[model samples]
Target: MARKLNDIKSDVDEKRFLFHQFFYKNIDADIEIFISHLEKLTKVFIFSGIIRDFFVFKNQKPFRDIDLIIEEDLVLEEIFPALDFKKNSFGGYKIKFKTVDIDLWVIKKTWALNQGQLKFKFDYLNALPKTTFFNFSSILFSLETKEFITGKDFLRFLRDKKIELVLKENPYPELCIVNSFYYSDKLQLDMGDKLKSYLKSNYTSKMNVESIQLKHFGKILYSDEYIRNKIEEMFTN
Candidate 1:
C-alpha cells in the first residue's frame, strides 16, 4: 500500500501524501483531548499501529485503534465519568473516544510483566521503537508535543517502499505473524522477497503452510480491528 515518493508522480499520489501529512499534523489534537482528561502525566505517546497505518503503510482502511502509552498510570474511571471502559484481556484499558477507540497501555512501571514483552523504565523514550515488529512501525508521536521518535531504518525503509520484518530480538512474534497475514492478504500488499523468505523460514515448518494457517487462523490476533471490535462488544453490557 506504500509507494515510494519518487514513484509517486501522479497528482492523485501527491494529494494522498498531503492528506496523510495533514492527518499527522492533526493527530495531536485528538491526542490532546485524551491528555486533558488525565492528571499530572509528564509524558504521553501514541505509537505502533496507528502511526504505521497513517504515515508508513498508508493503508486505505481507516485506523482501527490508537495505541496510547503514558509515563504514569491513571485510573480511567476518574478521567471519564460518563463512559465505561473495558479492560482488555491483556492488562490495559480500551475506551472509545467518540467514534474511534483508543487502547491505553502503560509502561510506567514493570507492572504488565508478561513473557515475551519488552521492559522499559518510566521515561525511557527510546523504548518505543524497541518494542515494535518492523522498523517502519516503530515511530511514535508525542501526545503533548510536536516532537516524535522513529526506528533506526524507518526513513530508509519508507523511502524504499519496502516491507521488512525486523529480526532483531522480537518481543512480540505473535503480533508480527498476525500483522504480516493482515497486510499481505487482507490489505492486498505485495511482500518484499526478504520478508517473504523470513516468514517462510521462521513461521512455516516443514513447508506446511496450511498447517501454519490452521494453528494461527482461528486464534486471536493482535490487530487493531481485533482489539477495537472486542472492546466495542464489551461496552454493550
Candidate 2:
C-alpha cells in the first residue's frame, strides 16, 4: 500500500534521532566516494532528481539516482558501462543507467540548442559563475562542501528582484510534447525510470531543458495554462 504522507511524517519525526545518527555515517562516506569520482572526470556537473532532493530535502533520505552530465559524448558512451551502469538510449537528449530503483541520466553537450548552447561555452577557469543555491552549491559531492553553503546562500539564490530578473526563453518544444505524452499514459510510473525511453523515441524533436542530464524541461516551459489543461485532460479520460 502507498504510505500515507502524515503517517510517514509522524514516524519520521519520532525516530528523528535515529535518522540523524545513521545520516552522518552513510552520508559522509557516500559523499566522499562521489567527490573522489567527480574530481577525476572532465567537465562534469550533477543534475536531475538527486540534485532536486539534495537541495530541497537536504540529503535526508538516500537519493534514488546519481545523474551526471559529461561534456564529451565519447566519455558518456565509453565510460558509463565500465562503471557498472547499463546504458540505454533516452529520448533524443539523455541516457539512462538503472541501479536498483535509482535511474541516472547523462546528457551530452549540444543538449539544449534553444538555450543558446553558448551559455555552456564559458571558460570554466575564468568564468565559472559565482556559486548559487540551485546552480552551484546543490551540485555538490562532498559533505564538507555541502556544509559550506548556508541558509543565507539559499535565500540569495531563490530571492527574485522583480526588476532585475533575467529569464531566458525556453528552447525545447518537442521535448515538452514528448514528456507530456509519456506522463499521460503512465500515471503510476516514476518518471525517472522511463525518462530516457520517452526521450529517445522523439530524439529529432527539440527539447528545451538544459544541463547535461535529467534536465527538467518543466522548469523552463511548464506554464499554468499547460499544467491545468494537462490535469483536466487526465481526469476526463
Candidate 3:
C-alpha cells in the first residue's frame, strides 16, 4: 500500500523518504534509471503539479506529467542517451517512459523567466514559486538532495483547499483564468481573495475563449457559453 503524506512527520528526512516512496510506487519507470541520470546533473528538481497532487490527493489522482527543472545547460541526448526524447511546444524535452510522461527543461529557459514574464533572481529555486499562476503549483522537490522548496503559502493553500494566484502577470492570462476554473472544479477548492479578484477583473472582452481552448486543452473541453457562465458565476458568487 502507498504511504499517506499526512502520516509522515514534518521532518525533512521523513518527507524525503515519503517522496521517494511515492515516486517509486506511482511512476511506472525504473527508479534506478532516473536516479542515476539525475545524479549526473548539477541540480535537478521535480517541481509543480506532481508534488502538489501528491500532497493533496496522494496516489488517488493520475499525474498528467512530471515537470523537471535542471539548473545546468546540457543536451538531453547526452544526459539520457538511453531514452528517446523530443522537444515539447514550450521549449522543454518530453520523454515517455512506460505509463509516465516527463517534461524537463533548463531552469534558465523556464517560460516565465526566460520570456521576462517573471524575473530570475540569484536563487533560481527560490524564484520558481513566483512564476506559477497558482499556489498549488508552486512546490518544488529537489531530485538530488531530496528536499522540498516551496513558497510560504503553498502548503497552507493546499491544506485549506484554496486556489490563490501566485503571479498575476503571466504570459497566458486567458489560460490562467481557464485553469483557475478547471482546478477549482476538479479539486473542489475555493478561490482565494486574490484569485477571486483576478477572475473578476480579467474575465472581460479581452479574453479569447477559443485561443485558450486551443493553447491549453488542445481541444474544446468546455463550451464557449459554459466557460462564460462559469466565469460569471465565479465572480458574482
Candidate 4:
C-alpha cells in the first residue's frame, strides 16, 4: 500500500507543533514542585544537549528531557520521588513525570592521573549536555535549582554581547577535547601538548583569545576529513 506523502509531513509537523505547545504553554504541579526542590541544591549545573537545543536552535521551546548536574552525591531515589521519577545506578534517574520523559543523571567529579588537576568529567553519562524532558515550569525549576544556568544562558547571552563567536564555546571544552582525542595519534608529536594546552586554556581553565584557532583545531580534529576535504574541494569546483 502506498502511503500519502502529505500524511507523513502532517505527522511530523503535528509533533513539532505539539512539542512547541508543551514547552511554551503547558504548566503543571509535578513540574512546579520539581523546580522548587531543585532550587535548594548547590554546586549543580543544568547542561547537556538540551542546553544545545536552547543555544543552537530557534523557538525557545521546552525540551523533551533535561540534563542536570549535581556535584555532591545525593541519592536520586531519595530526592526525585515527589515528581514521579525513579532512580537507577547507571548513575541517573528515570522519571515518568508528566507528558514528557525525564532521564536525570547525577554528576560526580573524579581525579585524573594524566593531569594533576581534577578532570571534571561526567561519571554518569560520559557526556555533557544530557537530555531529558520536562514541562516549561520544570525547566525553569531546574534552572533555579542549580543556579548554573549562567553557563547555558551564556551562549544566548554572548550573542547579545556581540562577541561574534559562540558563547557556550567558553564552558564546553569537551567540544574542543574531542578534536584532540581523534587527532592525537595522527599528530602525535603535537597532539598531547595541544590537547593539554587546549584543555587548560579552554576547558579545564579559561581564556579569551580573539581568534578562531581553538575552534579551527576542534573542527580539524573531530569533524570528518571528508567534510574538510569537500569544503576545500568547493574552491576548485
**Backbone N/Cα/C clashes per model:** 0, 8, 0, 12
Residue range 43-124, candidate 1, lDDT tens digits: 6676667655655455434566667777676666776776658886556787766656777777543222333356553535
lDDT of 3 by residue, 87-156 (tens): 8666688887776678888887877888887656687778887788888877788877778886656755
Reference-based lDDT, each prediction: 0.55, 0.35, 0.74, 0.39
Best by lDDT: 3
For candidate 4, write residues 1-237 as lDDT tens digits. 534544533433344433434443544666656645765764445454444344335344455565555556666566664556665535566667666656554544311211223333433322232221111101211343222222222332223321112212233344444433433342232322223433445432232221233554433333344323433443465
Q: What is the descending TM-score order? A: 3, 1, 4, 2
lDDT of 3 at 78: 77
Q: Which candidate is the best by TM-score?
A: 3
RMSD (CA, Å), each prediction: 10.5, 12.3, 4.7, 15.5
TM-score of each: 0.60, 0.37, 0.82, 0.38
lDDT of 2 by residue, 1-237 (tens): 544445533443444344334434444454445435644764444443443344344564564444444333444335444444344444222333232222333333223322243354554221212222122122222222221112222223223200111112224445444444443332222222132333334344233333312454334445444544544554465
Worst 10 residues of 3 by lDDT: 3-12
How much does candidate 1 score in TM-score? 0.60
lDDT of 3: 0.74
